[model samples]
Target: MIEFRRNIVAGTAVLVVAAVSGCAPGTGDRAQPATTATGTSMVTSPTAVPGTLVYLDVAAGRPITMTTVTDGAARRTTFGTATRSDEHVLVPSPDATRLAAVESPDPDSVAPGDLVVISAGGARHTVATKVMWGGGSAPVWMPDGQHVIAAVGGQWRVIDVANGAATPYPAGPRPGADGGYLTWSTNGHWRAIGGSTDVTVTAADGTGEVKRSVASLPECREAAGCPTSVQAVSDDGRYVALGHMNSDPSRVTEAHLVLDMRTGGLVNLPPTAPGGSVDRVFFRPDGGMVVRTVTNDGRYTFVLLRADGSTLATLPDTTQQHPSGRNLVTYRP
Candidate 1:
């Protein structure tokens, strides 16, 4: 299995606690400001916004929660019992109605485990397998939403969510082939595979690859935290989000970065509010990006941003009691 480090930092400015999913509900684009508990304002609507943002609430029984833009309301739903913090949870389907996750009956083992598929109304299907689970390397949903792509014993496999059927998937390389972490876009057309020093953007079929060595950048050489893995990829494979790690091991700092595959340039999102840092960035299916921000006091907030880096809305706060305080599982938009 390809081991991965899941603790990568994401950052951006301002605050709005809301999720992004599906199409805009109303006929016209409306501008509304929702004040968060922190007294910050978030833009709730602007030009066909992606409504519905889903994420995992770890401290709360590890249940999956969905927050919508229209009312800034969140509804919590549990698929199954809680798994370890390291285990994957609530990887949403392409349609955002179903979710894919990994679980182990034997909780202490670090090896691969069974794949679980959870649909709407609390219905679930579990398929026994040895698929490795971790951040950015979790089971990925193909565009069809019925089948899932997973990494098994190092290579990729196409699994039928309806049944336990599986087949070898060679669209991407095996673990030892490049020693890089692998993450695929939901569209199944692009893959971002790389490590702390560099990242490679390529077609799903393994053609037209472009690699940039981040180790050569000033952030890797002179900054406190260096990127450790690729967190999320835009649907078109044009924008890539990176996670950073510091050498001190005692201090954690996240550098909010997005790589423009088209220009080979690195773009940083707006700065975060005082003592807050970006934790994760998930690209919405329709457009824009969902930025997960973390405060020093263990509060979590989700902000929806347009492609131009403007705030669409900010989801409300979700807190984690654990020392790690990283409760976000996945954001399905």
Candidate 2:
């Protein structure tokens, strides 16, 4: 029997209120303008543009919520429950109508875990694979919403929604290596995997085309300042965000690098060391902006930025309620 322990933070009661109110120390009252820790004010979007943003909330345990931000308000919609002890919710389609999520019933459970799907209205479907146990990782949905790609066991497999069948795809070498972190191109034509060596991109349909590769420090596990064991690919698939850190892991920062997949050119974005390293990078529906999270002592602060690496605004941390749960983000353009 494998039990997963959720870490709960103590003290800092005032910090909790400040986080939820989107006011981080010295930011004055909630009615005042939002600012970063450096006291830089941010512009708040008055209304959530209709069909413009999808907010990911892993506040709930097994069941997660996907909220649509429009007209400046949040409308949360409940998705299907997960089967994996450690699961991640993914939205790969551009229309925000389909979702892919990984599910492992037990930590010690073996092979053939499940890849579940949820339609826009929340219809559930499970795609079973031969990759048994080892636990499934993040799922990337294809643009058509009929297929999804995930790393099961040590191999990456693409599952078809119509038949709930999975086909193995070349996930770049190592069998047990952590190719778990994956993201789909906004068009859903390509999928990128981050693991032992460089980040590798491939076609989602098993077309066997090597799109491009962006090398990171060899041996990610052994890298000196690599803060994160996970990485995220932008929705457009033109950028990859890597979390850098010191030896302690607690002291971390983010390195956002824009990848010109067509030319194999990599440009590093301005470093944003927001207390903790950026845990996740998500593209807004407009494709012109992104949202990232930085965490410290189990607390998270969300930042909205432009593709050019400009800080737009900072969203209040909502992870206080579910300190142990992963924060999910999505957009509904």
Stretches of candidate 2 off by over 4 Å are 1-64, 80-105, 118-123, 129-138, 150-157, 165-180, 202-238, 243-274, 284-287, 293-303, 312-326
Q: What is the lDDT of residue 7 in candidate 1?
A: 15
Ten contiguous residues with the weakest lDDT in model 1:
1-10
Residue runs of model 1 more than 4 Å from their true location after superposition: 1-49, 59-73, 85-90, 105-107, 119-124, 134-137, 170-181, 186-188, 217-228, 245-255, 284-287, 298-306, 310-326
Candidate 1 Cα lDDT to native: 0.55
The prediction achieving the highest TM-score against the true structure is 1
Cα lDDT listed for each candidate = 0.55, 0.44
Candidate 2 displacement at residue 193 in angstroms: 2.4
RMSD of each: 10.3, 14.2
Q: What would the per-residue lDDT of candidate 1 be over residues 55-82, giving only the tens digit for each residue?
A: 4444335544433232344555555544
lDDT of 2 at 189: 45
Task: Give one clash count per candidate, in the order shown.
Answer: 13, 16
Per-residue error for 299 in candidate 1, Å, reads 4.7
Please write out the lDDT profile of model 2 over residues 49-138, one tens digit for every residue.
223455554432456566655535656666655433323334435555556554444434433456666665557677754333231244
